[model samples]
Target: MDITGAAAVVTGGASGIGAATVRMLAARGAKVVVADLNEAAGVALAREVGGSFVKVDVTSTEDLVAAVDEAESLGPVRVLVNSAGIGWAQRTVGRDGRYASAADLDAFKRVVAINLVGTYDAIRLAATAMSRTEPLDTGERGAIVNLSSVAAFDGQIGQAAYSASKGGVVGMTLPVARDLAAIGVRVNTVAPGLVDTPIYGEGEASEAFKANLAQGVLFPKRLGGPSEIASMIVEAVTNSYLNAETIRVDGGIRMQPK
Candidate 1:
């Protein structure tokens, strides 16, 4: 919907793609709330953008609900970007030199809990608040943009847990859109491939790693930037007709099998 004067909440707004979206949203005149576990970065970004910051753990119902309430105080939450997530690179079968063993259950569960289930938790609650909101001019209540990864489609050698967690986000997009269609709320996902987020390294990725990730990219021949993904998210939220879809922001790269 209209970004101007709209209240928006962005989980994982401390840095990376979430931070980029928050900046873009603020520039468009949306009243934003930075929701993330990183207090210093979140608060600093909020200050820079003239928005509020809420320390949130996506897995906590209370935290997610509280963020929704915080945004409501600014205005009806008309824009939501669920960008909070954790990543792991663990093979399903562990190596013990002579033999392989099953993966660690806790590691797998942790990834799913935050990246998958946590997304659902935030969306379910935020949509509840959005449902009560009066529809905008285009009959839109709000829009939700969830983050997934290209790994969901083509995971690397040790990314089983990460892939499964993100794949769930991709899987639920259509159903979520259908479920919220009656309320005029749209749901969509963006699965980015090999983004240059902090996850890779603080500044520049190693030459070898960058080359490896960029192997199949058609033109750019480099890692996608956070701003690129953020732009897609903002565009999706503003465009009322786009719904129940997962857009791949990869540079035409189908990740190679590891």
Candidate 2:
């Protein structure tokens, strides 16, 4: 599970948590492949890390397949990070008189497809490629770290779709880990609390929201840093004993209805 000189693929590597992960992996001597929908950002990030970029839409199987191929060509892909996901904040029925119609259902489906199905697709494809590689000293052929959210367990009022998708991810971790056991590949997830990622506004969150989030945190009464999540990911990958688990990197803050 040592990432040193290993080839790693990180989806949604253009910005936010994904970008932080890309940098962390690269710093650890992993030859990373940045897979993202943003071509320019992906390329720029890859260049900064001295890695490679593969433009990919995680919702498309073809795009994911191609990304895997490109990563494999670089070297053995021993690490896979699923960080690409979309968050939606619409109630099933809005007070503004917007009913949850066919279009709303379709939009929800799209979110699920991108966040859950897409993550599964990338994991399966990347794991298949990793299985073909020889095992390392730790008897580990590869490791996959999936990104989930605290909302999976503690959803806010308007986060139905986003929470459902993330909940699915949390549910899948154990079984996928069991399935990949024989191949020496480990699967795990990280459910983060409110982090200062782009998912929250570009800058700091609104004062009221920030205060609310920090209400019950044990320490650091503020949003988490992207590097904090990245650190856990690196640890999970490097520690072969860790598998089939979803660790919460939140500051002990379980969100509630505002």
Candidate 3:
């Protein structure tokens, strides 16, 4: 699909990979709506890209629906990027020496709700809107890109909830693509490795952990940048043939068991 003048919605656009996607899509002449919970950063990015900002909590259906409405006001949402996700570092059992408690269950539920269900919400709403647009030469009306992680496939210790949530994303791409095919909408995902995003803490990793990561990659020998991931997303949207696939942009890193 040609992105020029297309309306796009990028969730989690306030920072990190989402922020990079917003910038890249805007530069490609797509009118972007930066949907995020961080009001300040969302508005700032909106200004930077000459796009709109919709303060949205992906976990809240009301918030997501409202964001879709706001974005539709700008233009038809022909592109949807589900980049809002949270990372967790706790085991099913907690560091507090307790088994998975009610609080832990709640946290897991929240993560699944935000990362998986929330992504579906945006896709459903945006595809509905896109279906209303005239089809392009490739019979494509729109495209949706979801963010997964290498952890989805190669989950380490202490990543049960995070991995499960992202795995759900990876698993859904093909089915979602098939479901949307008749309407000329495509769905795909990107599974990134240790990215230079704040999802990891600011401090450098321990030498042991760094060495472990190094062993997984054949080259580049470092974390990926948000721009690199964004580039893949752009290609996924523009390349009509690239559908129902999860492209791993992880510098050949297949993570180790921690």
Ranking by TM-score: 1, 2, 3
lDDT, candidates in the order shown: 0.91, 0.89, 0.87
Checking candidate 2 for backbone clashes, the offending pairs are none
Using TM-score, give the best candidate's number.
Answer: 1
RMSD of 3: 2.4
TM-score of each: 0.95, 0.93, 0.92
Q: Per-residue lDDT tens digits of candidate 3, residues 59-111?
A: 78788778777777877678999999987766665556655442477778888
lDDT of 1 by residue, 28-68 (tens): 99989999999999999999999999999998999998899
After superposing candidate 1 on the true structure, give the runs of residues whose Cα lies further than 4 Å from its correct spot: 97-101, 202-208
Relative to the true structure, candidate 1 reaches a TM of 0.95
Q: Report the alpha-carbon TM-score of model 2 versus the true structure.
A: 0.93
Error in Å for residue 170 of model 1: 0.9
The ten-residue window of minimal lDDT in model 2 covers 94-103
lDDT of 2 at 249: 99
- Cα deviation at 82, candidate 2, in Å, is 0.4
Best by lDDT: 1
